[model samples]
Target: MSRATPPSLPFPPHIHAWPDRSTLLADRELALTELHRHSLGVHRVLLLWLLALAAIIGWSLLVLPVQQFEERDPTGFLLGPVFALLGLASLSPSVIAVVLAVRRDHQIRQLLDAWLALDSAPVSDVRLRSPGLSLFWLLSSLAVAATGLWTSFGTAAGAQAGRSTYADVALDMGIGTILWLTGLIGVVKAVRHYRWALRTLGPVSTAGRR
Candidate 1:
């Protein structure tokens, strides 16, 4: 009599197996590399946009007729410069934070090397979190955009009263639109990066817990 054949396994044996240490280390390195590249790219883009905005503001201040702006809405004209200055100043912290992130990543690389060479257990205590650079950019951009919107509204009101021209309102609106779009893009990028980091690194450990 022929014996019945044994049933086949549902999947390959390897499918349910955990990754080896080398594989895990390789994955962690790749993730860190990708994160570094993405963060650097974001930093460069933000810096470029900020510099462009600053240059545009400076050019406008030099070329535009200050007297005409003042006549349109004295309060808005004064507030515009103040808001721009504040926005410019806010970027400083983000720049410093980006630099720090780069340095931290470098340190992490060294730590990874040591762990691999020593064949030690991976450090589960270390965790990565979202950097606040994006939020700062968002807030600063919003402040500048708000200034532009206020200026635009003031100019439009003045025009209705025959005290300002449509051109003034149009200019303010354009600046406001640019600022808002730039800020929105930064915010989206920041949130995306944050989510990506979380996904790549896995869930963070709770405070006071191993």
Candidate 2:
């Protein structure tokens, strides 16, 4: 009689019960890539606004020598420092965004290690745990607008100084308008993206069962 086929071996305890570590790592990697992509777009937009601001500042410097600084609006003079401060404030959101990107990247990489399989975190928890970059942008943009208003005050002051003519005032005001518009657009886009990311990720309530 033919011998009975050998019985099938049982799977190892840990291997059979636990989820695959490699699969979890792969998922985390994909998520990290998407986060980086979105963050890069936001950074690029900010860079454009920054470049435009630099251009305006350069133009202002060039004209200062040729045209008399007219101080027309008394309030405009006071706005000079205010606008400068607001511009400084805008840095906060950008810095936070960078930090958030770094944190996510590091965490994802660590999760890949075989020892600690990446656990599924609730979307709400992830969003809450991560830094809020959008809020920073919103606050900073408000500061930018406030600062621009202050710059207008400075322009008026220049008119009052009677150093520059009507044309100079118009030019300064026009430049201010452009900067404000660009900043506003950037702020709006940033907010929209942040909201979209939050929604797309959705909320995770319970921990991964496996």
Candidate 3:
């Protein structure tokens, strides 16, 4: 009887079998690089989110002392619903991010299963990171809220005294200036980043469609 030999396995063209000693080290390094990249993206998203939240909280606190509710008149009732809606709207992106993160985690799991089964794995598209949409929403909400607060409170305060003091004028000016500056900065940054991301990601999208 002739001795039987094992048949060689075929792999996809993109996959290469490394020599025994190099295999472990090479794969570990590749995984490390991937993990590092993912970490950086997560870090950036978190940083921008926290910065936006902080700015909102800070601006709200600064204006809280100056808010006068009495002279707000008929529009006063709208504040409750407006703020509630703003809260809901502002939460949308965070919720979307969480859902995407969860979905990506599931995809990673699926990819790992394919890898372990020695099957060809699908490539993941790296999404272009931009804080543009979130920044826009944040700025818009802040602007509306800040403007409402100023209008309502300033009117109420001014109605009582019928005159604006230097201190009152200075405080009002300072708050308005800060809110405007922050909103403008956010808008500028968001637009620039968004444009860049769109341009950069356009080719990626086209390749994906093919």
lDDT of 3 at 162: 43
Model 1, residue 34: distance off in Å is: 6.1
Worst 10 residues of 3 by lDDT: 1-10
TM-score of 2: 0.44
Candidate ranking under lDDT, highest first, comes to: 2, 1, 3
Model 2 Cα lDDT, one tens digit per residue, 105-153? 3443333222223344343224432335656556666666566666667
Cα lDDT of all candidates, in order?
0.48, 0.48, 0.43
Cα lDDT tens digits, model 1, 50-162, are 65476446434432444345567666566767655664465444445545644654554444333333332325323334355546645665666566567556655666645
For every model shown, what is its TM-score relative to the native structure?
0.44, 0.44, 0.34
User: Model 3, 1-210: lDDT tens per residue?
Assistant: 111211122233233554542453345334423532342234434444454454444444333333433344455465645644554455455445545654553454333323323422113322333354446544664574466457546744664354654435544554454445444443444454455435533444463552
Q: Cα-based RMSD of the predictions, in order?
A: 16.0, 15.7, 15.3
Q: Cα miss at 96, model 1 (Å)? A: 27
Residue pairs in clash, model 3: none
